[model samples]
Target: MNENFQAILLNVLPLLAIIVIAYFAMIRPQQKRNQKQNALINNLQKGDRVITVGGIHGTVKSTGAQTITLMVGRNQELTFDKLAIRDKRPS
Candidate 1:
């Protein structure tokens, strides 16, 4: 029983180390990116040029309570959820 428990602990230790490494290498950066994206979306206003999650690029035409209107090109308009905006205007 003692040997079995020791072997299991050895195997679990490496897995736990891998999980920690993965979290720092992959998960942490992704979370930071998500937070930044959320901040950008929350601060959106009219006249801001934005890129959507679906890859559409447009200028914010109007803002509603839960939706936003985007003008993709000349005379082309679209509406999407506020959360779907991926980025704001370039400097």
Candidate 2:
């Protein structure tokens, strides 16, 4: 019974350590990035230039509850979900 308990602890201890390390190394950074992305999306305003995950670049024309209108070209406005806006263009 004592040996069995030791063997189980040996196996579970490494697994638990790996889970903690993985959370700090991988999951935590990803969560921070998601929070930053959400903040960027929430702060979007008209006339801000932005790039989408699809690599589309445009200026914001308007904002809706869950969507934004971007003017990608002259006389051309495209509507996209708020999540589709990835990052604001630098200057």
Candidate 3:
């Protein structure tokens, strides 16, 4: 009985360790990044400079529930989904 229990524990222990390690090494960091991105998206404001996921850099002109308008050039304003924003640029 002791040997049988020990064999089961040995087999399960490695899998449990792998899961815990993966959560800390991979999942936790990704989740933190996602939370920070979400916070940035939620707090967007006009006049803030931001870059799009597609590499377009612009100043925010307007914000909506699901979209934002950006002035990319002197007379070029583009509208995009809120999710398209990648990161805010420093003033």
Give the residue spans of candidate 3 off by over 4 A.
none
For each of the candidates, give the backbone clash count.
0, 0, 0
> Which digits, one per residue and each the tens of the lDDT, describe model 3 over residues 1-91?
9999999999999999999999999999999999999999999999999999999999999999999999999989999999999999998
TM-score of 1: 0.72
TM values, all candidates: 0.72, 0.86, 0.93
**If the candidates were sorted by their lDDT against the true structure, best first, what order would they fall in?**
3, 2, 1
Residues 1-91, candidate 1: write the lDDT tens digits.
Answer: 9999999999999999999999999999999998998788778888999999899999999988789999998899999999898888683
Give the per-residue lDDT digits (tens) of candidate 2, residues 1-91: 9999999999999999999999999999999999999999999988999999899999999999999999999989999999999899975
Which candidate achieves the best TM-score against the true structure? 3
Q: Pick the candidate with the highest lDDT.
A: 3
Lowest summed lDDT over 10 consecutive residues: which window, candidate 3?
Answer: 37-46
Ordering by TM-score: 3, 2, 1
Worst 10 residues of 1 by lDDT: 82-91
Model 2 stretches astray by more than 4 angstroms: 1-8
